[model samples]
Target: MQISSNEIAWRGGKVVLVLPLPGVKQTPPDSPQLQALYAKLEGARSGGAAVAPRLPAADYHQCPRGTSVRWYCFYQNRDWNENVAGRRLQWSDPHCDEVMDFEVYSFAGQTSSWVNTGFLEVTVWDDSVHRLWTEAPNSLSAYVGSSNNDQARFFEACA
Candidate 1:
């Protein structure tokens, strides 16, 4: 199912189960979790559309250390429990408009962090079918590199 809106529910509130595109089976109405989620969405819907937050790019750069920068890929999946074997990271960039790949990571209930697997390289192709690539140093220290696209691509390739 296609998720048309990144922001669901109404303004000044929270969203429960992000409604998947229509035609996707609605969550079981009797389920308690589903009920709670429905209530939040209903409140948002009645409250109007002004409550949603603006979403940033699919992937973005961040500086963990004062001088070092790293890339991060963000996403969510219903099946993404705390112990999934693999997670897919998707992102976009100038070199590659869209890229998706599986990566090794551990989710702690709802959040997960990427772990380096030692192989750092962008092994995906751009929208035009041209392969996009980059090289990463053993340590992602300051001045080493600074691009979420490259970091995400490398993890995806390793997976």
Candidate 2:
């Protein structure tokens, strides 16, 4: 999906990762509601939802090396001690000297009062190759599958 610089900076988020994908091409969401209004919000089903931009194969392939592919959702709590279900991978690059960094977002970037307590599942994708840090879910993790994506370890404040 293509977006203007203004749109990206304002609403595209700090890290805009792909959820349902082929690492190149992703299938469309089944539900129109899920594809349209509901998924585009900030929270999960409550108030925060995010739209997984449908990028064409050609465009996806041409993406820059430093592009950030992010997935975000509402974390329904402030205090966290238990580990949630997730996957850990160390995304790497073979050609470039950069190591793709991944993070299970905390509440540090939620500066707006209008938006709910959201957590970002962020990771940097290089053009060459990628790697994983861990293999299973815990307090901080994320899965890398088309249907099993967005398995992060966070909660919303409303919980």
Q: Per-residue lDDT tens digits of candidate 1, residues 1-159?
A: 212232222212221123233444432112344234334444454564322222234321110111111223222322221232322232212223334433322211221232211233335333344444333422222121232232332222331
Measured with C-alpha atoms, the lDDT of residue 46 in candidate 1 is 54
Residue pair clashes in candidate 1: 10-44, 11-51, 71-148
- Which candidate should be chosen as best, given TM-score against the real structure? 1
Per-residue lDDT for 1-159 in model 2, tens only?
222211111223333322222332332222343234223532332333464444334322211112122222222121111132111111111212332222343322221111111232233222222321222111232223332233333222110
lDDT (C-alpha) at residue 121 in model 1: 39
What's every prediction's RMSD, in angstroms? 16.7, 16.9
Best by lDDT: 1
Local error of candidate 1 at 149, Å?
Answer: 10
The CA-based lDDT of model 2 is what? 0.25
Model 1, stretches more than 4 Å misplaced? 1-118, 137-156
Clashes of 2: 26
